[model samples]
Target: MTASREIRLAARPVGEPAPQHFELVETTVPEPEEGQIVVRNTWMSVDPYMRERMDDVESYLPPFQLGAPMDGSAVGEVVASRSAGVPVGATVVHFLGWREYAVMDAAAATVVDTALAPAEAYLGALGTTGLTAYAALTEVAPVRQGDVVLVSAAAGAVGSIAGQLARKLGATRVIGSAGGPLKARKLVEEFGYDAAIDYRAGSLAAQLAEAAPDGVDVYVDHVGGDHLVAAIDALRHGGRIALVGAISTYNATSPVPGPSNLFSLAAKDANLRGMLINSYFHLFPEWIGKAAGWLADGSLHTELTVAEGIAQAPAAFLDMMRGGNVGKMLVRL
Candidate 1:
């Protein structure tokens, strides 16, 4: 019997997940059933959304069960196949956990071309992160030419892509807010953001004003709390706000307050809409086509912070949440 090493949820975390929250175990790899394929995982994605699942609270998605493997986006090579459509040796992406191997139905996996990009890219830039950014910019909040666009968490996987996509969509000014100076520089110099603000320096409101003096027409909010307040204050008349992930308040035990200036929405006639990327799956193919073209032509660049093994997944996740990572955080197994 083939054996696989997996990471299971050892405890429900109250705040940020610690090493104690996970336990490693060895288990026998089950044979592929009627329509299943066994894959040897190569990489796994670590995202902010996983923090929501660690708690028992009700959410858009179910909580992670204790003692069970934690699931996220992953890329793997099919080592054995019992399904007709899936072939052995194919590399596929799936909702597989932090395991060395997984056996899942063929239908649940999306076959990817390893020749196009690295296997790990399927779990990041070329995968969910890319799709999420594309959907937010194109479907959730469409920015027109001459519009001023602002993005929070500007150095992150999704936010970086969103900023580039906004520019590509013909936004006259693309501004970004990041935690540090390096990320701020990256946003402007590398990602084509017209201006970048270092939110950690001082007041976000002041930084926002300097970065987007004309007022932002579209705000892609990735961090909530103070950033949300700043975005509200910086919005132009009839602006649009796309609420993506609220990374700032994710670890807070109490409910984070909404912007005090939410009344600005009424005063400015602005629109604030929450976006859940899964809701726009029907438009994914179109978004992918656009992003793929940009990626091929060097119009879009991807930044990844990769951990070397599955055992480092928890540490990598905690680092990402703490802003230790520059871009997408992933684990290579």
Candidate 2:
């Protein structure tokens, strides 16, 4: 057995999670048995979806059980293996994060090539973060030539990539909405957005109108409250919305109402579709190849905000929830 440090849910968070809600525990991790492998994690991902899981309420994913390690995406090097499929020293990706080490069935881990990009890339652009953007744009709300697209949380891990993908996919104009000026500027200058609206500055609807005078054909929603309503109001005929997240309401203690102008969907013949990345894993191979090419050809640029050490995972998660990170928020161990 080996000693491992892990973060467990001590209590269900009330609003935004606090340090008291998490407990850091050090325990012995048993050796991998038959068909099992042990990984020493190098990088782990903390995303907005995890915030929902912190609550005990039912959602797409089950709530994190109290006194158990919370899991997400983690990439690491296998130090010991009893399975023939995965050998020692192989880099692997699995859903066993919030810890320094993970021991699980070999089938639970997917061996990844570090040479392709890096172990961290698998948790970011080439992994779940990238796949989320790709599937949402291509399948949920595809961009067409001459179409105007708007992405909320534009400077975030998924939104950053989503904006760039829309542009590459033939959107004539792309607009983004972020919280601050720096992130807004980064969206326009770095992420290829034609306009970046500071949702903190004024009315989102007015800003979106000014950004796209002709109205938008595609709306990639990450912040759902007022942003969804704004997109609905600004959508032209046959506009499509990819509802990926509702970060604004993720920590709500009360029921948050949907867009009041949802009637506009019928009025404008628009479509709104929710996206869950787990349901689209089949498209991962295709997306990985395309995203790899984009990365190699300088067409895709990735940014990361790394929080060092396993102990900092809670702080990193909180910072991400507060929109403190511009791109992907990762905990590097």
Least accurate stretch of 10 residues (summed lDDT) in model 1? 284-293
Q: Which candidate gets the maximum lDDT versus the true structure?
A: 2
lDDT of 1 by residue, 248-315 (tens): 88888888787889997899999898988789877757766676677778988888898988889888
- Give one digit per residue, the lDDT tens place, for model 2 in 208-317: 88899889999999999999999999999999999999999988998999888999799899999998898899999999999988888888988999999999999999
User: Which number leads on TM-score?
Assistant: 2
Clashes of 1: 0
In candidate 1, residue 222 scores what lDDT? 89
Off by over 4 Å in 2: none
Q: What is the lDDT of residue 221 in candidate 1?
A: 88
Candidate 1 similarity to native, TM-score: 0.97
